[model samples]
Target chain A: MTPLLDIAELAKRFEVGNKRLLYAVDEVTFAIGRGETVGLVGESGCGKSTLVRLINRLLDPTSGSIRLAGTELADMRARAFAGNANRARIQMVFQDAGDSLNPRYTAADAIADPIRRLKKMSGASLKSRVEALADMTGLPRELLSRFPHQLSGGQKARVGIARAIAVEPELLILDEPTAALDVSVQVVILKLLQQLKRELGMSYLFVSHDLNVVRLLCDRVLVMYLGKIVESGPAAELFADPRHPYTRALISAIPQADPDKRVGRLRLSGEPRSPIDPDPTVCRFYGRCPRGEPRCSAEMPVLRTVASARQAACHFA
Target chain B: MTAVPALAVEDLSVEFRTRSGTVKVLDHVGFSVDKGETVALVGESGSGKSVTAFAVMGILDPAGRVTSGRALFGGADLLALSEHDLAEQRGRELSMIFQNPRTALNPIRKVGQQIADVLVRHGGATRPDAPRAAVEMLKRVRIPDPERRVEAYPFELSGGMCQRIMIAIALACRPALLIADEPTTGLDVTTQAVIMDLIGELAHESGMATIFITHDLALAAEYCDRIVVMHAGHIVEAAPARELFAHPRHPYSAKLLAATPGETVSLAELASIPGGLPDLRRPDLPACRYSDRCERRLDDCARPLPHRVIGERHTVSCWNPL
Candidate 1:
């Protein structure tokens, strides 16, 4: 079966000053099937943002191919891609709806702007479509006249979701959609997203640092270290039996409410290596990883599979 | 076999004078953190968790005021102290680590100077020794290449590094009590664990008490020795970590446990606490703030609530507790 999105040998690098070249993302590859939800989990500066930007064509990849619905996107020009109808069918919802939504724009206008830009929506038809999207997302009709600042965090999140689905997109990239919300409200938003995905048959590229939320939402998970994909597999399988040492450390760090069931505490020692001018010979997780070996410093390990759809980059694995 | 509490708060009622009217944010709220103990003040947003911290720290905004309360810290009423006395107490006897490390640390100042400032003010270090002590603190918090990082600005460091710098500054004086208000909210789960471990270890070493304020019940359960669950400006439950999870007496506490996602169960079993916190400004507020949303609310819930002891080191404030 053809995948909805596929990435191969993706790498992105940026030059900082005259002396250093920052490797923002390095040799990452993954695919998302239709209606599948894949979570990209990592700490800050792990290149998850760079990978998403590369896939979305917001930033040009240094070298790689991003096939969205079978079309290679790396070769396209910015304006050409923006004008492409397929671009409208793939949308993104960013972190913090309050920050992303324009304070001056009302809920209706915020949702309508994307539709008007992409679908050429206008007049009464545009108004009706905006209301329909709001209704679908369970947003109150009374909130249409309120600005972003006037709405609550959950309501603002709904406005953001309503806007993303206004075009009936086949793919949605949600970047920590529930990170800023309260836990109770977070549950409601997650349920809404899950329902929408089922109803619309859309694939999701979910990005977050919260492992529990990722576990709850994604079918598969990708673990990233300093600008590299350290591990990837089915969420349940990888979490239950993490092949990579770094993945195991991450899983163990999650604090469970039940104090009786204490997981062994593993604090990752030392800081992560700098992204700029990284040593090509050294592994990304070498210095901080608890299980690092002497050979880890000499050769960079490649992603090797331990089971079906499960890959981890480690000498021990 | 418990020593006297380092800080004991009683009938601590705080209100904010709003343009609309006087909003009773905290009503007769009280808790205590014994010496060398870790107490987690857990609650949702707008549940007066951070407000209580700010009130204790004497950092409440101008719009807010403590109407009535007694906060006895080190045998002196913190509420009765003048602004000057409270200023002297800060950074020496009491200190706090805020939520966002990026914003908490001074952007223009070098990380070393920030830590040194605390050392000079509270640790009584000479100017010459301040820099070295600052680097030592940095190393203590497990930041790599402490000497180099000391000279670097906050922006130059990663989020986790910035957080460590914040922790270094907070622990520089080794205060008797430390208030960490959502210290790891913005950090990754891995980094959060590391930071919490560092704080816990240092606090234990110094025999210092800590009041950890967070919305994540799972995190609090892991790090805290005793858990104090707050709801709508009131402490709903206080229990030992193991006992609270095993047999949660408060309805809110039970709901919170069920809401937290775990490795053992599917998402379908997770249940969220329904409804928002009651507006404090409303005139028609219930005597029990959680009564409106609680599933097991009784007729007596409308009356003034009192703490009911269930077991050793366990107390809950609910008329119809689970």
Candidate 2:
């Protein structure tokens, strides 16, 4: 069966001063099946956010194709894409509800704005649909009258989710949805997303730097570093046995609650190499990798199968 | 371990006078930190974690006031001190590392000058020694090329570097207590690990008592010697780090643990605490703020709350505590 979303050889580049070009996201390729939740994990400046923006068409990719339901959208003009019926089929829930939501808009108005703009619903029918969505997200009916400033963090997040789902999209992209919330509140939001996915049969592209959160929610995981995907695998398998040096370092860096279990940690040294006109032959993890060898600069390793259900872009792995 | 705590707060309360009404952000909140110890203040937003820090640091907003409390630091009543005394005591006796390093540091000022300002103002360094002392402080915080970087502005440095500058400023005077409010909130996890390690190492070298305020349970569990769980302005539970996770007594505390994404639980299995924190401005609130959300509510919960002593150091403020 064809995947619900298929991305092929996606790349985005920006020209900096001195005529140097920077590859923010190098050639990447991945696919998401219907009702599947694929997690993209990386540190800051690893191109995770850029990758998402490219997929969502918030920013156009420099090259490559973004196929949604076998429809190519990479090269489409912004205006033409907006009018496409497929626009409502893809929706995004931004990272922080507080930051993403406009302070001037009330909770009810925020949710209704998207539905009316995209679907052009109005009058009493729009009001009823907005109320139904509020009920679905477990938001208090009375809160529909409140502004963004009056709601709690969880309530604001509910409004964000409610607004995103009001159009009944086929795919939802969540960008660190719970990073701004406390653990207790984060749990409820995660559970709500899980239930919604089950009920609506919508696929998810969850982006986060947190390993623990990805472990709980994602079916598969993709680990990126320095604008490249270094590893991809089943979430459980990757957590159990991280083959890539970067993934190993990331997993070890997580501070375990059980102090006894936290042994020596592999602190990756040095900052990421400059992305501007990087050497094509050099591995991205060369300098910072503890297992770096002289051969690392000779040729860049590509992602290859290391286990039955896992792949790592490391020569040794 | 020391028999007595280095900093102790009892019956602490704070309120903010807003247009709507006086919002009681904190009520009867209390905790302590031993010298050379790390204590985490964990709670959601408006749960009074940061407000408690601000109150202790004498930095509460103009509209907010410490209504009642005793914060005893070296037998000094921090709450009752005058603004003049608090000013003198701030960086010398106690200091804080504010969250969001990007905005905390002055954008146009040289990083070195900023650090030097703290030394001259609080460390009593002579004019000639202040610059050298600032450079040395930067080196201590592990900033590379300290001399050149010191001349750069806050905008030139990375998030981690700016945070190191903040730490350099906070520790330049070697205060007895350090209050860090979400110090590593926005930085990458790896950077967070390094920043936390640096703070822990410095506190150990100076034997500085630390009050780490954050909402991330895993991070708090990783570093804190003790953990205090707050909800709706009240400290619902306090216990040793291990004991708190192993056997949480307060229903809120247990729910917080259950909510955390750990090695044991999948995201789907993690349960969020039901309902939201009670509105502090409400004229009528339950004796126990969590009573409405808690699944284990009891008949006695409606009455005045009770502090149940479960162990030597563990305490729970619920009538139906686990």
Candidate 3:
């Protein structure tokens, strides 16, 4: 079966003050099937944002290929891609769109912007479609006229989601969608997104730092470290027994409410190895890995198959 | 804890004179922190958790007034102290860590100088001696290259490093009580764990009472010994950490616990708390704030909020608690 979205050897880099090159995203590859939810989990400076931007075409990739339904996305000019025919096929919902939503625009107007720009629908149809999107996102029609200041956090989040899905995108890129919401409200939004995925048959690339939320929502998970895809596996399988050492530390750090379960400290200390002008010879997790050996510094470990449906970039795995 | 609590608040009511009207931000909010104990103030935004902390710290906003309450710290009512006396007591016996360390830290000043300022003012270090003492505090918080990082501005450091500086400044004088208001809100999960570990270690070493104000129930469960659930300026429930998570008595708490993402059976089991927070400005607000959102609300809930003691340390303000 053809994947809804596919990428190969994707990389993005930036020059820092003419002295060093920052590998915002190193060589990485992944895919998402139709209606599948794949989570991207990583810490700060791990290139999670860079990967999402590359896939969504918000930022141009330095090299490699991105195929959505077999159409090449990387070759188009950056400005041209914005107005490309395939522009409406992929959409993004950013974190804290509460602040991102234009203060001058009402909730309805915010949701209608994408529809007008992408779909070219106006007048009565646009108004009706805006209300429909609001309804689909669990936003009340009555609150449509309220400006951003007048709307609650959850309501603003709904407007953001409603806007992103207004054009009926096949794949939705959610960058920490529920990161700014309270737990109670977060659950509601997560459920809403899940239901919408099912109803609309849309694929999702859910990027978040919260592993528990990822475990609950994602079908598969991709773990990144210092601009590289360190591990990938089915969500339940990966979370239950993470193969990579970094994955283990990330999982151990989650603060669980269950008191009967006590987490042993797999504390990751010190900053991650510099992404700027990284040594191609050494493993990214070398300095911080608790299980680090002499061999780790001598060679960079590639993502080797660890299980039937899992892979991890670790020598032991 | 042998005689007087490290800090105690009673029947605290606070109001803000907003343009609309007097907003009752906190009502009958009370909690106590024993020596070396960590209490978590957990609730949604606008739940008055932060307001309770601000009221106790005697740092209420200009428009805000503490109408009725007694904040007893070291047997002295903090509410009754003059501004001068309150200022004197603030950093010496009581200190707080705000949510965003970047914004809280002075942008123009060197991070080292900021910590030194706290040391000189509260820790009784002389001006000439404060910088070295500040570096020692930084080392205690486990910052790498403390000497070099001390002179670095807050912006030069990463989010985690800035948070460490904030922790160092807050703990400079080893205050008896520490109020951390969403200290790790904007940090990554890994960094959040590290920061919490630092706070946990420092609090244990110094035997300081801590009131951790946050919206994350899971984080509170992991760090705090006691959990205080607030809603619309009222203490809905307070209980031992394990007991509360094992079996929450209040409807709001059960919903909050279920709503939190964990190794849950399924997302369908999760439920959002229905309805919005009661308008504090409204005179006709319900006595039980959760009643508007509670599925199991009873007529008795309308009379007046009833405080019930379930276990030795468990308390609830619901008429028909689960």
Identify the leading candidate in terms of TM-score.
3
True-contact fraction for model 1?
Answer: 0.68
Alpha-carbon RMSD to native, per candidate: 1.5, 2.0, 1.3
Computed on C-alphas against the true complex, the DockQ of each candidate is 0.68, 0.71, 0.80
After aligning candidate 1 to the native by TM-score, how far in Å is the CA of A69 from where it should be? 1.5
The CA lDDT of each predicted structure is 0.89, 0.90, 0.91
lDDT, residue B243, candidate 2: 88
Give the DockQ (C-alpha) for candidate 2.
0.71
Q: Is candidate 1 or candidate 2 better by TM-score?
A: 1
TM-score quality measure for candidate 2: 0.95
Candidate 1 per-residue lDDT over residues B1-322, each given as its tens digit: 9577988988888999988988888988888999899999988888888989898989999998998898899988988899999988889899899999999999999999999999998889999999999989988999888889899999998888898998899889989999999999889888899899889999999999999999888898889999998888888999998788888999998888887776675567778788888888899889889998988887898888978988987989988888
Docking class of 1: medium
Clashes of each: 0, 1, 0
**Chain A TM-score compared with the true chain A, each model in order:** 0.97, 0.97, 0.98
Q: Candidate 2 on B175-242: residue-level lDDT in tens? A: 99999999998888888888998999999998999999988878898898999999999999999988
Residue-wise lDDT of candidate 1 within A200-299, one digit each (tens)?
A: 9999999998788899999999999988899999999998889998898888889876655565756788778889999988999988888778899999
lDDT of 2: 0.90
Residue pairs whose backbone atoms clash in candidate 1: none
Considering only N, C-alpha and C atoms within 3 Å, which residue pairs clash in candidate 2? A216-B267
- Span of ten consecutive residues with least summed lDDT in model 1 chain B: B260-269
